[model samples]
Target: MMFKTDKQTLTDLNVLDWNSASLLRFFDHTLTLGGRDQLYNYLMHPLTTIEEIVERQETIAYLSTVNVSKLFDKYMMVDLERYLNKPAAPSVKNRTSYFLDTISFNFFSLSAQREQLLVRQSVREIAMLFTALQDIVAEAKSSGKAVGLLRIYADFFSANASVFDKEEMRQVGRGKSWRLTTHKYNYLFRGKRRPQVQELFNMIYTLDALTAVAKMWNEGGLCFPRVNTNDTAAALLRIEGLYNLALDNPVKNDIHIPSAQNIWFLTGANMTGKSTLLKSIGICIHLAHVGFPVPAQSMETILFKGLMTSINLLDNIGSGYSHFYAEVMRLKTMGEIMTVDNPVVIMLDEIFKGTNYQDAYEATLNFINSISGIESSLFFVSTHITDLGEIVGMDSCVALKHLETKADPKQGAIFTYKLLDGIATEKLGMWFLNRESVFETFRAVQPRKSSS
Candidate 1:
């Protein structure tokens, strides 16, 4: 009974992909307590054989307590500040300065320290300068609406801002709402708007000069999810007892690809998932590197600049370009995209399928050679060309793996579709075609003893 129960549990778990089941480790963090459900799905997908993490809505909502709510508010405010300081979309300089000003309001409203600094200096100075009308600036300062009051001062300065850097305009921008003083204080000391106002105005004038720099943050770039390396991840797909789809009773496992550094050259019989395996690794690597939990049971992969594919190469439609020319252009473009900081993970299905055998192999060799030296880049190319592994592995720059095919009497020719080291074990399509009786006459003739 215990054995049956355990078998049932494994059966239930096997319903999830091997990779997906493996990622059972990422969720054990104090931080995940807030974004509980989302975090759970994110972490659980990589650590264990669980596919239905999203259906656990009840689990997530239960964790959102009042204390958690408060923590979320703190997180948002902190993130707001971090956003202002860090680079972000629309990458504009003045816009970013504006974002800093926007963030300053959050600080001012939440903390006494910020409020005092924001309005005190300018309010005291303004009151002293306009002794008879000091109460207006002082009241504005005392009220917990300093940001709005600063806007009013900015507007007033705009109206009288001659030469763009006039004292009135500069003070509003630099001291903002802080340079104000009371009528009582100003009555004892006399001056025309004050010399410090001119200095403050000068300081604010530079803010526009920085508008260009601020734009960089405003123009957003690529955004991707973050994956924790220490977290367990799931697989998108796996096969067991396995043809590509897997078998009913097979060795249940979480086969983890080890610290594989070099590019894997997958060669196999005609129908094997040499290409499928290539695509699987390509897609999973992309998703994982960008910080999304993969469709695997678990994953541990290095983050890279981007994943590129030469699989869907389309021929150029005539700006005077041949098929080979178009392919070369595409390969060249892929090569050019890789630079020092922004590296690439490229997938090349076949080096050159457009030309004759010798030329195709030669092109394939050179392409791999050119791309192999970069430490940050990886390329996987699938081929029916037998000598490809020999050509590429000779350089020690390529790693080799192949798929296996089996002849199941009931299933006929079945591809196990397993990833194995060394060259492919069979020439699948050739052998199957020979068995079909379609070549019966050809086999019967058998070159009948040399025509003497």
Candidate 2:
């Protein structure tokens, strides 16, 4: 029951790439290697259960309410990870080796001092982090919500509060000299205390990742989606005020696909926001599955097994796949996936665009005909083939919709970016070409007939 999505779908949704337009880039606020890795892990694999998703959302919500800015020093935690990952010589407790090690330390005083400082920094950060964990626990208890993750960390902290509260640690930061602080940390971290330090480091990594999620949720004013996992097959998706998170002033629109209608046939002229709408839906599904707040005023949808999208298809030069062949292969892959029993949400933009109009129209119509019967999943297909809507609209399972546009005569076409029922019959392509004087330019570039 693992929540799944492919690399192509991720790219289509603009999720993971480091480009400024990626969804991950917009939400990533991690300051350490561990935190960044953790965030990436979550994005790659979303939780599959209702309870886990809600628990995670509650944990993020509670965290967003608290300002734990001083809990962990970003630089110190990064250096701590670096030090821990650094290769180390195996300890040799024999008397001969001990004496040799002591002599080696004398020769490498500068290196020893640097190592001591690293250890001191680690101890200070861990201590501050432990205190921060306790504060979160208090907040969780006060919130009266089921903050399962935070409570687990709080319990672990409570069980080991003694080691952190020890007199040696109390003197760690109070000492005036770096050598003295380092010696105290070294003494306190010996034996069982070493494992305690490791556990605290792990907690810091988890908290940092959570903190990044919470910060984004708060800043974006994102709301937790009402995920309906009860219907495992053919569930509905209703999102109000949905918009692209990457855009500065995006036009929000509502979308709804009742259980009776699973396939959405969207039609609109270019720049009418059809692709953006598809992307927004995909992003919302992904973020909701990740247990983070979504970029919408409200969202309620069925828990899909996975999301599959084909928006940005490209030719495979190395594989010798033409653009049309590549698109066909991608659709073939989706067809194969649909055969499986698990439910999935499928999205395709301008399918079969690489081929001629006759073939593209026929192929797209056949494709819609084949998938319209799938009752265990949802389908969203955006295309300029408005005729397909007429044919597909006859099906009870298909919903025909369009993003409407208006011609301003003087200002040209004014795009509303609003979703509406019924198919689009507007033929604005020629209008746009005429407005741009494309035919005049072509005429000017032609050879003169007078020469003949």
> What RMSD does each model have against the real structure?
20.1, 3.5
* Model 1 stretches astray by more than 4 angstroms: 1-260, 318-321, 408-412, 435-452
TM-scores for the candidates: 0.43, 0.88
Score each candidate by Cα lDDT: 0.43, 0.78
Which residue pairs show backbone clashes in model 2? Answer: none
Error of 2 at 427 (Å): 0.9
lDDT of 2: 0.78
- Per-residue C-alpha lDDT of model 1 across residues 1-452, encoded as one tens digit per residue: 00011111122223223343332222222232223333333322332112122112112222221122212222432332332233322232443343344345455465745544433443443333332112332343465332322334444544534423334433443444332322211211122333433333322222211111122212322112223222332321222221112223322222233223356576877667655565555545533432333334444444345556666555667677776786787676666666533434566665577778999878777776776655645667777777877777776656777777777878777766666777775666766776777688677775767676
Per-residue lDDT of 312 in model 2: 88
Among all windows of 10 consecutive residues in model 1, the one with the lowest summed lDDT is 1-10
The TM-score obtained by model 1 is 0.43
